[model samples]
Target: MHLAFVAFLVAGISDAVDGFLAKRFGWQTELGAYLDPIADKALLVSIYVALGYYEYLPAWLVIAVVTRDILIVGAIMLSGMINRPVQMHPLPVSKVNTAGQIILAALVLFDQSFGLNLVKLTTITVWVVGLLTVTSACAYLLTWFRHMSAYEADVHSSLKQQKDGSQIKPRHFGQNPRA
Candidate 1:
């Protein structure tokens, strides 16, 4: 438990340092944009799963966290498959959700490592994490649905224009249709 706690702390510190360096040195890249979130998700998901496996965290909370991630990724993939790839921007609620999850995980790890009882605090944190997870998931789903609906409306409008013979035709350079 001590080793696990130390490792978690080191990982968190390293992530923070990496972000600081990237921003301070203008070392950001497109790949980093994608990789950063992936790394964070991987870390948090793994921690939650491990804790739940050891009975340190509730099984339902673990499921909720994992499910939320899966749903978000599935939605993105679905959008791409349908030829309307959605650019993902993290919602505000998601940030708070992640913070709560981290706090809960840390609290559990700290308590276990030091042989300290934090049942009450841990319980409250668990509830907070659960609520944030659900809320964040709903927020993301709502955004995705809205985006897809707008895309559908756009496609319908374009189709209607074509059907009505109201679509504009491109003119060739140095060539006239009337000539």
Candidate 2:
């Protein structure tokens, strides 16, 4: 259990390493798009579970983290429902929240070595970060809604204009054969 918790921390650190290397070498790829968040989620959720199981951290902390993930999952499902895909772009607040989580989790594990309670400091900070996490989730939702709304409006406007005898038909993709 202890080793697993530390493993999660190391994996979280890898996220930063990958980000730096990607930006430094222009090695960003579609796989990183999926891998980065997945790694973060695994690290976070594993720590949450370990802490809660051992009662090192309050159960509510884990609940809060899970709730944020639920929000993200809901957003993905909503995007799918609307037929508009969403790209995972971590907002600044989200990145901060993630960093806070990684720090708090690592601190919790370190506290075990010293047999001292670090939850007092980590708990307060976690609450602050949790609030930011929720805020970021709401921001993502708003952005997704606006994007899908604009797409629907554009489709409707094009259809309406076509119905009203507008001679400007929409062009097909990459087919500008000058007739």
Q: Give the number of the best model, judged by lDDT.
A: 1
Runs off by more than 4 Å, candidate 1: 158-179
How many steric clashes between backbone atoms does each model show?
A: 0, 0
lDDT, each prediction: 0.86, 0.69
Q: Which stretches of candidate 2 lie over 4 Å from their true place?
A: 1-5, 161-179
Candidate 2, 34-99: lDDT as tens digits:
887776787688778788888877787788787877877677667667554555666676777787
Q: Weakest 10 consecutive residues, lDDT, candidate 1?
A: 170-179
User: What TM-score would every model get versus the actual structure?
Assistant: 0.88, 0.76
Relative to the true structure, candidate 2 has a C-alpha RMSD (angstroms) of 7.4
**Model 1, C-alpha of 47: deviation from truth (Å):** 0.5
lDDT of 1 by residue, 1-179 (tens): 99999999999999999999999999999899899989999999999999999999999999999999999999888887977667667888899999999889889999999979999999999999999999999988877777776666666777876776553332221122233
